[model samples]
Target: MGLVVSHLSIDCTDPNALAGWWAEVLGWERAWDEDPDDDEVGIRAADRSAEWLFLKVPEAKAVKNRLHPDLRPPDGSDQATELARLLALGATPVDIGQGPEVLWHVLADPEGNEFCLLLRTPAQVRADGD
Candidate 1:
């Protein structure tokens, strides 16, 4: 009676380069290869905890992303700690019109896909835009 997400797929200009960037972020390894002759990469979280797949696409991104993922440190961890870690790993800050008081920091990968670092768990996100 419940639908579960098996994996998250992203379209990128370079699969291998994007996959490598994500692998460093999630501490994941290559899970599988979708094609041998073509470039499609699957990067899975360490211990197979989750999956994120990157596929090579021809079209360039023209507008903001409609959906994005938020990465949060495990329970009891603080956002600043994880933010520093991710920045050191090559993620750059993205100006998404959010203010300093916001609970999440927007960042872009090497290829410009926008993702966020959340200060709280999904259930703890403030409902009101206060």
Candidate 2:
């Protein structure tokens, strides 16, 4: 059988805070009890289909990420509304040479890990045959 993918892991300076921030952004919940001094923290989707683990690291992020998540809005939400909500939740825009006309908005979490907010919702994609 082919290998099954599990959780995505991220290295950060403060696991608890970063994990909490991501949980808020994705509407997920903590996977386990939070310990302020712990070196790792995790959050998972409500259905447990997706998960991300944050690992404590001594060094700060020094460059753009080689890998990052591209988020699309869920069925009931549109890109603009989701973008505003993400900004209000402490996400900052990042310009990684994507240029002005690109279909996605690059943004960084509290710890500078870059991710993209894509232009279309799932429903839009379905309707447009994209």
Q: CA lDDT, every prediction?
A: 0.81, 0.95
The 10-residue segment of model 2 with minimum total lDDT is 73-82
Query: By lDDT, who's the top model here?
Result: 2
The digit string of per-residue lDDT tens for model 2 on 30-106 reads 99999999898999999999999999999999999999999999888988999999999999999999999998999
lDDT by residue for model 1 (35-80), tens = 5445678889777878887878898666678898888775556789
> How close is every model to the real structure, measured as TM-score?
0.79, 0.96
Displacement of residue 15 (Cα, Å) in model 2 is: 0.6
Which ranges in model 1 have alpha carbons more than 4 Å from their true place?
A: 33-38, 75-77, 121-130
Error of 1 at 81 (Å): 2.4
Error of 1 at 54 (Å): 0.5
